[model samples]
Target: MNQQQSLFDVEETIRNSKSQKASEILTPSTRKILQLLTSQRINKVVTASLLDLAGASHEIVQYIVGPIVTQQNGWQQSIPSWVGKAIAVDRLDTALKEIDKGEVGKLASSSEVVALMMPIAFEVPLSSEWTDVYLWASYDALLRHRPFENFKYDKLWEKIGTTPIQYEKIRSDYETLAADIRSRIVKHAAKEGWGKRSSNKNKHPVKATTTESNIQMEQLSLFS
Candidate 1:
């Protein structure tokens, strides 16, 4: 009798947990931000960062979104400061040297430049310290529509010559990267104990806050 009662208690607890989750509500600010993501009005992974920052002080949101918002509104800017943010700086330098030696002859387009860069960029493990620095530098360059932003392009031009790729192609590539980075962010959140996995194998658990769960649902509705 006691054993049967214990199993019933466990089932009851799980039911209550599921009920709580199903009843979660979205705050107004979170709902607005999620609408932006769902409608594809703001299509970068930075929108996920904004979802993370929502419900914090207004100043924090402004500080985080100011430059991106400005760029969205037709103000062109380059993040020149991302020049040397790589952990494996030597790796990139060596790749440049190899290119100079004609290891790959005439990188005719930005996609080829990215092909050369991909291996060197990911040589460091994504779980290793400072990995996000490298990832963000890569993501930001694409976000700013400057695929060659991290390279010493003047020096590169002198070596492999000018490699121009279409803006539409770059945008398509950015969409793929954004999807990848969104997955990484969720896994990282789980590692940090801010998220819990659901019973559904396909769904990733998000942080158990009103805003976070709402954001997660919005992402899932659009993506999954």
Candidate 2:
């Protein structure tokens, strides 16, 4: 049937696209935890918590893991829920406010300050619309480690607060990442389509190659 073939086509396209992102897999330890999830050696939910905790620094891990492994209560229960909240985050200013409040507070308070998250050094020189797009896309790049949906060239650099010396030192990489990001974003959009979802009132689909997705990613970039 036509629907069956369409599904196969999408599967093939996604498989190929996933291959292109071979560099984006989780770290070895994280991967091992994922394996445990699949193997059922540990509870799937617990494994997710462990993997999420893997993102923390070694000292933090040491402090937390001991209690998690030893405690009889639901110490690990809150972790996966927390990670779920993190990956679903949707605003940058929320992150700023969260950090400003301190990570020792609530679930939203003790948030990860994503690396490569640069301070707003200079005013973004683009138009208001484009400026918003560029910032969101740039943050999405760091959040997802997927370059697609990001700004290109100088727009990319400016959003990340790339210092002058660092920019010059790695200018070539910046250009390369920008190109790849744009291409990926376009390809992702084309593959996902430009339709809107019925469940939401927004004009954009939850995940599409159009401005709606950009808006969503932009919002998420700020939060995550």
Q: Say which candidate scores most in lDDT.
A: 1
Residue 26 in candidate 1, Cα distance off native in Å: 18
Write down the worst ten-residue block by lDDT for model 1: 213-222
lDDT string, candidate 2, 165-200, tens digits: 333443444444343333332333334332112221
Off by over 4 Å in 1: 1-160, 195-224
The C-alpha local distance difference test score for the whole of candidate 2 amounts to 0.29
- Per-residue error (Å), model 2, residue 41: 19
Cα-based TM-score, every candidate: 0.25, 0.20
Residue pairs with backbone overlap in model 2? 90-219, 90-220, 91-222, 91-223, 92-222, 92-223, 103-110, 189-209
- In candidate 1 the C-alpha lDDT for residue 66 amounts to 20
What clash count goes with each model? 0, 8
lDDT by residue (1-224, candidate 1, tens digit) is: 33234323333343444333211322333343343332322222332233222222222222222211111111112222222122112222222243234342111122212322343344424442233333333443444344354666445323433344334545544445443433433344444333222221233222222121111111111112
